[model samples]
Target: MLQAKAYFDTHHHVGVIDQRIFSGFLEHLGRAVYEGVYDPESPLSDEQGFRRDVLEALRAMRMPLVRYPGGNFVSCYDWTDGIGPREQRPVRVDYAWKSRETNQFGTDEFMAWCQETGIAPMMAVNLGTGTPKEASALLEYCNLPGGTYWADRRIQNGHEQPYDVRLWCLGNEMDGDWQAGHVPAEVYAQRAKAAAIIMKGLDASIETVACGSSGRGMSTYLHWDRTVLEYCWENIDYISAHRYSENRRGDSAWFLAEGVEIDRVVEDYAALLNYVRGVKRSQKRVYLSFDEWNVWYKNMEMDGKGESAPHLLEEVYNLEDALVCAQYLSSFIRHADVVKVACLAQIVNVIAPLLTKRDGLLVQSIYYPIVSFAQHARGLSLVPALECPTYKAGERGDVAALDAAMSYDEASGTVAAFLVNREQRQEMRVVLSLGDQRFCEVLSVEVLGGGDAKAANTWEEPKRVTPRSAEAHVNEAGELIVTVPAPGLAVVRARVSKR
Candidate 1:
């Protein structure tokens, strides 16, 4: 039998886990807005036209924050076009996704959804075809008290109180050639700096994020980041990073090793952030916001046809994809000190975890792991020392068969360990060591994966790929022993005491 050991020390910790790390994103592309979150025509929708089923799922995820308006859709978007009465709202062509965007669900609508869900808004402005003044005015409209022009306009739009949104993204992927109004790094840096100044001047409490590279695959990846930081490091509070993984190569082992890629990318960017701080010798520190990330290579074609709520980029996640998503949450927890915020590229329909149908929705396989970590992995991040067997995964080199991260909640004295077994056909015996801490009780041991790697949750079989409770016990040595299945993600929760 394959064997491994995971050692955890309650005293050694990374940092307080940011609940925003489990945050999600919602863009205007596809049915994420119209049909997914705001389906007025559906019988399941509430009085406000928001889908009750979708809101219930999102609320259960317990996401502290959610990014809104656009992934690429905000580039050519005008905030004013989305406010005021829906009858008077204009329908415009979305240049990014090549779809029709009705201004019906604008700033007020998004704010209403956020309020309903109790999730804070991470607003992104239009820096692509928009100017710095426009960015500041949008900030004024959302955050300022109703004495000014934009604030008064917001009040006239039926929202009397300010939105008071704290987190602001300057733009989306400014360095990507695919982005609307894409510009050189230097030009983007200057524009971002000016916008940051104006927005911050309007509301000194709000935090701003400068666009970093779209992904590490871009030719301008780190170079773009360096130039932007070199120019606007002082003005920005955080830099953004977007990444998406796929199994297009048909290599399962290499695909499962994506956690390696996520870890290295975060480390590299965190180092770059530190380097910039040193170069400028500034007291102000900027962290990373992995604002856009998910598995998104399967549905590369856009079938929108310039219509409303068209299907586009709706990638159905499978068992293998669930393991990767778990690894994503694990990596974010591991680097809690540097990576402060991360939004799972989308929340529903458009390359998301929950798939919505006109009648109902299917909770994809990826949703299990995401919810597991979001709900259980809280408090301090405990460093887990692992001695596990490794396999050579193509270009990723010697990848560990076991990927894991542990967290401890001091108030409850509970220790939750998130583990992923990467081997395809071999179940591994894992001995979880708590060192001198005494294991009090086993709360739960839930495992996901072990069936077909390509198995997914469809509308016909919604519960086809769900997690199952596994048996776990502690030995006389006080070490927890559990058998993690091949190609599986497991969450082991227990109460520990240091008597």
Candidate 2:
């Protein structure tokens, strides 16, 4: 039997959990916007053309924020074309996705949607193919409370009040050559610094995020991060990082272990930020915005095909993908200090947890972990010391079979632990020790596993692979014992009385 031990202390706090870390992203890619989230033609849509089914699905996840209007789509996008009446909104060729851009859904539509769903809007300004003046103008349009040109335009357009969006992205992946108007680190940094200065100048309350390397695999990687931070450090409040996991090699073990890679990325980026802070000798600190992340690899076939194909990037997630997603959330919880905000890239149809059809939607396997963590993993993050059995994976050698993260709620005295068992066959028995804290009772225990790694949900069968309640109990010695199945994710909540 595989064995693991976890120790959690209330005083050893990692960071205050940011609710925005449980955010989602919606882009104008594939069916994410037109058909997935806002389908006026569909019978299931609301009067305003918002898909009611999709809205309900998103509401269930309790997403705190939703990033809008782009991914690669923002790089070449003209924000002005998307505003005003739907019929008057111009249509352009989206060079990034090779699709026709219908500007029907713009900033106004997004704000309306956020209001309907009770989610905050995190907008991204177009840096590529757009000017800093335009970026500042867009900021003024959304934030300034009427009086100025853009602000008055917004008021005249329909919304009398401003959006007052707090979080803003400078650009999307400026380091990638494939991105429209992609520039070198120095050039992008200068542009971002200018935009940050202009937007913050317009409204001192808004926070800015400068684009870092697209992923760790980028040729520049940390160097891009360093250069961007060095140039735009004071102007920017957060630096952005984007990552996507895949199982191209068909190795389940290795694919699941890839979750640890995210942790490593966060650590390295945090270290880089620390080094930059020291080099600058500045008192201000910068946090990370993991604004775009998901499992995306199966749908690259139709990329660059242009308007001829509209639905090219819808990826169906599997059981293993869900496990990996849990690990990703666990990593975010573990590094809450540095990672203040994260948006699950494209939250509706394009590589998203909730997939939508014309009539309704399907909750993918990855959706359960997202719901669980978003609902329960709140309050202060705890640094849990863990001892577990090890396994040797191909490239990610000597990996821990079990990975765990814990959160403590002082007001309610609730302790929630998220555990993942990476082993393929063995059922690991876990012993959790809460030092100097008396265990009251197990509030809830849910495990997401049992199906094949490739198991997934379809339109016909939406509940094929989901989480189920597990058996957990607190022993006489104040230790909680639970068995974690292989290739599984478990979330446990218990009431604790402080001694």
Candidate 3:
């Protein structure tokens, strides 16, 4: 076994764990909305047309917030087209994904879905082909009480009360040329500033997110973020960053180590945010919204094929993907202070954790780590100092063999640790030392690994890659000695007693 030591001190705190950090994303693209979450034709659907099974899955995950409507789809989406009578809704051509938008699910429907599932809505407006006035109208419709045109229109459409959506995104990836109505950084910054001002002026309580860069690989990554912040830092509360990891080279080690890239992405953006804050000499701090992220490389050819193309971008995740996702969540916990919110790109079907057939659904391997962290990892984030072995990879050289983060809930006297063993063949012997804190008993230990790294949960074998209970114990010295399997992820919980 590979040896490692982890030190956790209550004094060495990062920040309070934001529940929104574990949030998910839902877009209009692919089967995410049509067959995945809203399958009115299926027996699994409820009276409202929302799939009961999907709702159950989402509820089980304890997702706190969900970003609504569009990834690229939002760039050309007209919110009004989705509201009012479904029969009268127009079938517009969605240039973003080259699909025909049936306009069945709109702003009202998404808000209603969020209400039904008890998740907060993070609404994104169409800055690509939309104006500040249109964005403000959306705010009025969602947040304002009846009596005004848009507010009363919302009432006439059936919802009597306001949705009171607090989080808003000014645009979706405005910095990318691939995005519809894509603008240069300076141009996008000005437009975002105007939209932010207008929307906030309409509803001061609503928090707005300015589009940063699409990803770190963009030609203008941090520069785009800096320019947007320079122009709209005070107006916007958060800046949006999106990333999608891929195993295109078929390198398992490189694939599992993608979390290192995610960590660097957060660090770079956070550093930029801090630098901009200092330069402006502004007391108002702008945090990061890693609102869109996931592993998306499997079905690239099927995307952008227009209305004829169905089942677009549905990725079948394997054991390695799950490990990478777990490491991503661990990275979020490590930077809880700067990364205030993160949406797992999507929640269902389209490169998502949950996949659906016509009448049934299969929970992907990535879903295990999500629910594990969401349910167990809460409260204060502890900055754990780790002494672990390292390996030399291609790009991310000298990467640690083990990636881990810990959280302590003082009220419940519970401490939860999330660990990922990145090594392909070596199980890690991890000795966890909590300074002056005694864990009386090991509460639970769930490990998500052991099978083939490429093995995935199929409809026939849904339970094939599920997490299993692991052996964990508290020694006489009150430290945790746990064996983390190679190429796996583990969540360990313990009852911490007052020393």
lDDT of each: 0.91, 0.89, 0.89
Q: Residues 1-499, candidate 1: write the lDDT tens digits.
A: 6899999888888989988999999999999999899999999999999999999999888888899898899999999999888899999999988889988899999999999999999999999999999999999999998889999999998889999999999999999988898999999999999999999998999899999999998999899999999899888989999999999998889999999999999999989988988999989889899999899889986757899889999899999999999999999999998889999989999999988888888899888888899889889998889999998788888989999899999999999999899988888889999876867789999999895788898988888899999988988877888888788988999988885
Q: Which ten residues in a row have the lowest lDDT in candidate 2?
A: 300-309
For model 3, give the 10-residue run with minimal summed lDDT.
Answer: 301-310
Pairs of colliding residues, candidate 2: 98-306
Q: What local lDDT does model 3 show for residue 464?
A: 89
Model 3 misses residue 84 by how many Å? 0.6
- Cα displacement (angstroms), candidate 2, residue 437, comes to 0.9
Which parts of model 2 have CA positions greater than 4 angstroms off?
302-304
What TM-score, to 2 decimals, does candidate 1 have? 0.98
lDDT tens readout by residue for model 3, 1-499: 8999899987788989999989999998888898888888989999989999999999988889999896788888889999999999998888877777788888888888898999999999999999889989989999899889999999999999899999999989998888899989998888999998988888888899999998988898898899999999889999988989998988887777888899899999889998999999999999999999888898784454666226888899999999988988899999989989999989998899999887998999999999999998889999989999987655677788889899999889899999999888888989999996987899899898864789999998899899999988889988998988878887999998767
In model 2, the Cα lDDT at residue 496 comes to 94
Per-candidate TM-scores read: 0.98, 0.98, 0.98
Model 1 global lDDT (CA atoms, 0 to 1): 0.91
Query: Any runs in candidate 3 off by more than 4 Å, and if so which?
Result: 302-304
Off by over 4 Å in 1: none
Query: Global CA lDDT of candidate 2, please?
Result: 0.89
Each candidate's clash count: 0, 1, 1
